[model samples]
Target: MPLGTIVRLLGKQSQMGYLDEVYNSVEDLSSDYFQTKACKAMLLKPLNAASSHCHRLKINIDDTKPREVYVCKDTSCYAHCAFSSVPDTLCKCGKVMEYAGDRPENDAKTAAAGSDNGVFVIGSQKFITTDDLQIGNVKIKVLQTRINSAVLYAEVGHDFVDLVFGLLSVPLGCVTKALSQRLSKGCIDNLYRSIAGSAEGCMGPDYKRMLLAPELAPFFGSGASQILEAAESAPKKIKVDSRFSCFKIGGFSNLGRCREQAYRYNSSYGCNRHEFTYCQNTTKTAEICELDPKLHGVQNSNCDAYVKQGPQSFMVTDDLHVRPLTLDSSLRVVSEGKVQMKDLVEKEVALTKLQIMELQRAALMTCEALSSVLLPPKKKKKNLKHLMY
Candidate 1:
């Protein structure tokens, strides 16, 4: 088991007040304790909803597109006029809206809100002070408007009650459903699709139908086909030289000594390999290579690339095996060697190669072996015994 897992298990036991009995033989530990992150996400689910309950509505007025402030034409209601682009639409008060003018200054009596740019004036005369707008089955009334720089803001009727209900009334299941709807209809997940669809066929029909040109041929235009045909008809010769390391539209060329030869090739040849790095020819420094967004995007990066393989797949299977020592065995051998070294150093002994071999044969000897190597030889004790005889 991992050390993190052991720590988490002990934490759980302490939380349950079962620390004493946690090490019992048959503790009822759930299989969840052993599960991974993906498994936990699949199993555990939230039951109660939790939210900040803060949602604001702001109306931004475009100054450049001046003559199109939207207002309802119904003379009865004065509270529902909004600055919308859609000129012809039914207002929340069921009145037809039309383009009033550049500013809503004409209806001064309905001018409830004022800003530095202009003022917000209501269009309806009959309905003043209160008008309700239905947003997701919640009929919120317009209370008053406030100036917010270039934008105008309004507080909904019963705003406190609505916030309280948003926190208490909605369950977790409903919250999940609302989140799914928000993701799908909020123009977030499908925003890229909408943008891609809008830009379809923007490069014209001929470019869309064009095929990839052969190497050493005109990549586009009328001469592309002719150039490709000539290269096929005649045995086109391709010179391979180690001098130039990069390829370009004008054939192979050297971009001098630079690590970003690929970027230089794209800039000179008008290739879309590294779009972000193109047109940035101040100084071909290493910083430009790091700034390329293609390295972090869908395009494959030559600079930083990552490849992953499973641990089992990389395990050694041949006779060239790795043998690792256990912690206890290594510690024991190190401790013994340190003791033997300390004894020899204290005796201040020096031994010849032959005496060193003899010490090894004695299997780590005492101070006697060191004294024998260090002391001078005794003057023939056996000769003294022969003279006495």
Candidate 2:
């Protein structure tokens, strides 16, 4: 009996299940890809900068097989899509990138390490609390405090506040795993662990892998405050030559249909399949070289910064509420909480990937997410000379 037999017996409609999931992801692999071309145009660099920085996916098309092409000219790609390995100008498909050979023969093979987007590199610029989110030497101001035992809210930038709010965007599986199942998140941890490597027939390993460490949805992610280990995967695209192909091939048989003014068939004067062409000769398969894949409508899979709204000083409450920061709101936190002015402490800590996990767990378990993750401020030593005077 089929698995849906019980449902069928109950007089409910059901369809046969299959192992394969067939869908044309590259349905719009043409139409000039104006979106991607435009996105590339936007990622500008300084005139003094030696190398170019493009945070976009390249469409790599073989004879028919198309895949993603990852390229980073700089040795240090602090933020990148997918897994960025040693910056060697090596595209994801192992093709030596065009820039790898740009330098001298000996200097081209310089050593490079894997990307560590977890922490800010030494001496690198930090984010300033301004509307532009400018890069400068700045520190994270006091965002929260504790007077005696009660914790009070602190004013923070939109990026800083995102460290706590990003929890909602994360999937349940990632939430549980990132916290190492330390948080009390019901039985989700068990459900994630119970999935076996092999499925009887209904699914494959890819499903399991995706569930284990799912990537963020396309074009959605933390701009610079990437506390979580989530990233967007490569884009989906069609073959480069897929403007059109043979009728038998491009007529929705093995491949998808061709584009407008881009259809071809046998070239025989009276060939039965020769509907688009005017005249021709033999119907040999080698003559199949003339046709290309008719690909159109493909949009740019590139992504922009997650938060592009005009910069504003965003305030976050203990209960994870986000809003614009104002003098009244800041005063309200102090008035309502009754936290002492001198009691509030500000300390700078690296918001690395691991620390992000702690934030996620604390956000779920308690309202004081910032205070929960932040260690108690250390007491400073008294100035002996000044105090004595």
Candidate 3:
């Protein structure tokens, strides 16, 4: 867990009666006792809620488009809106919701949501998995990679390695929002929800998108791995309303001039009567009017990459420990897992968008990302079907 997450959890628990809880030592505070206490509040939500912690509604987990959910007029219960099927507008908390009829517009990101830029293929690699979630070094056997049985490690080239290493540049808010707060970290989900709810009407859509789904800093993105799927925001430009038009200083008569006879101010700022130009407002002094809106959007970015391209092959363990592929390193991993040659089997795993997302989520929460995401589930295990998106 991040230090910020820990600090926020501690702060919240302190007010909820941390002093009364019994613990053997200060280290015990990090145990499940406190974690359960924190999650206890959200337990009141519906077991199948397809929304976020802030009561924002979504049709499903991968509902990229944010829907306008009904809110309670009274403060009885701020839980998410739930349908009772018998004309009762009940909240997830079982309280009647006073309908606030105004449904705001969807978030700005909705426009670009699900818009694929192009096919992003990471790399090709051969992997082996074992039933007990441990495996050993074996003869180099290449086969079609499979996703369902990768309970061990992956041997990959620099492309896949660069993609994994590129995960550091992703914003935590984007990941949390992408996962819909299934991050299972400190109340980061709640914090993100609180900020989102508080800034709904106060902030612009662009600002809201920035807060919730911030993009990588200019020139710092990996083109090979957009698993997080955060679209780069277009440059925001101020548009001149039709109520006002640009006049050449004292050239009000120029409005009727032909395109060639127009006297307008042109500058080296790349504004050839395109971007911002001298114009008098309706009731104010001379201001600027925008003709074309693409001036400021030209950002000089290189390859949208961070790591240098190379031929280095690496081994990523189930626990996400990345190391160069060498006999010594492979031997150490196999010895640690206590795996044998007989217990291992190879599979072809494709680093697609969805698979990468699962890997990213597992990497954030546990060391056993491979086992947790790729390992087949037991028969009795209950899956989060609503969150499958």
Candidate 4:
């Protein structure tokens, strides 16, 4: 009942010469001829309708040359190695040709081909030439998957061929399922176990016993061994007894024995020897003290009393030699000061009361003035007119 089906039926029955006439008639048919059928079906109906006239489908392959092989100049591929000619079925690096036939020598050549430099594969699907490979395409994904799989297996101590085979054996769907599985519970555990075993095999018994314990799970092998070894060899905390030596406080030797002796004797009294001098009479003395040589007296007599010239020769005071104060003196000063502060506060409260009362009165007056200015005016009732019917 559909227009395409009608056209197809007509095309099948009609003679080759009359096919075009039938096709033209179908094209002129109403747009409503078919509903819910595929547009492709309608479009192809004309092709079928005109196909009886000895027409054949022709496909053309564009005249594009294959990309030239760029042999790496690195030692990995042995580009430096001399060869008689480019091998018929293999590259100079032993990689099998793209169109190599299945032969023993070709297979052997390819198996031996790859070096540390690059990979060589036989029968790899040619999605595109190396030059034609674009950023976003299936080719890139496949290449990445292959490279990652190779690296993974290599890390686990598998040879390239074995790694490739192991990866290839895994179905893409299984890979998807593996990816979807929990990494901690499954993939990571297996990976850890494999790496641990590889390390144990390679590193010998001492490492195996110390590093690869099954109980450690994720933290097995060299990582664990390194941590344990580091911890064992780590620097220890050494307790050293540091004693404080007594510092001999004294005056400079150049200032003479009196000054040195004075500093030595009065160090306990917190006096620098050169700062004060003992005088005999009211006259100032220039005679240096026998104990403190730096102190020059105004006169040549010895005095029992000492005078300290205040800093910059300002005020003079008697030395009133006080004994060295004990640590208890510092504590008493703090305690007495606190008690004095409390007594002063108790006496000051009466004086503050009048001032506080005056402040409160000023605050109240300010608040009243502010409220009168900010408050809204009270609304008055509006009188309404009443109409009597």
Candidate 3 runs further than 4 Å off: 1-150, 202-206, 223-225, 232-302, 379-389
Instruction: Mark the 10 consecutive residues where model 2 has the least summed lDDT.
Output: 17-26
Off by over 4 Å in 2: 1-139, 143-148, 196-203, 223-226, 238-304, 309-311, 340-352, 375-389
lDDT per residue for candidate 3 within 322-381, as digits (tens), equals 556788977676667666656676775555566667666765666456676656664576
Candidate 4 Cα misplacement greater than 4 A, ranges = 1-184, 204-210, 214-389
TM-score of each model, in listed order: 0.12, 0.42, 0.42, 0.12
Tens digit per residue, CA lDDT, model 1, 163-235: 2111111121222222332322223324233223433533233222221111111111111112112121111
User: Candidate 4 on 13-73: residue-level lDDT in tens?
Assistant: 4222222232343244332231111111223221111111111113212111111111222
Candidate 3 TM-score to native: 0.42
| Cα error, candidate 4, residue 294 (Å) | 63
Model 3 Cα shift for residue 135 (angstroms): 45
How many residue pairs clash in each candidate at the backbone level?
Answer: 3, 16, 8, 14
Cα deviation at 195, candidate 2, in Å, is 1.3
lDDT of 2 by residue, 34-143 (tens): 12221111111001010111111132111110121223323233322222111222333333322111111122211121132211121233323333221111124444
List all candidate RMSDs to the true structure.
Answer: 38.7, 20.6, 22.8, 48.7
lDDT of 1: 0.23
Clashes of 4: 14
lDDT of 4: 0.22
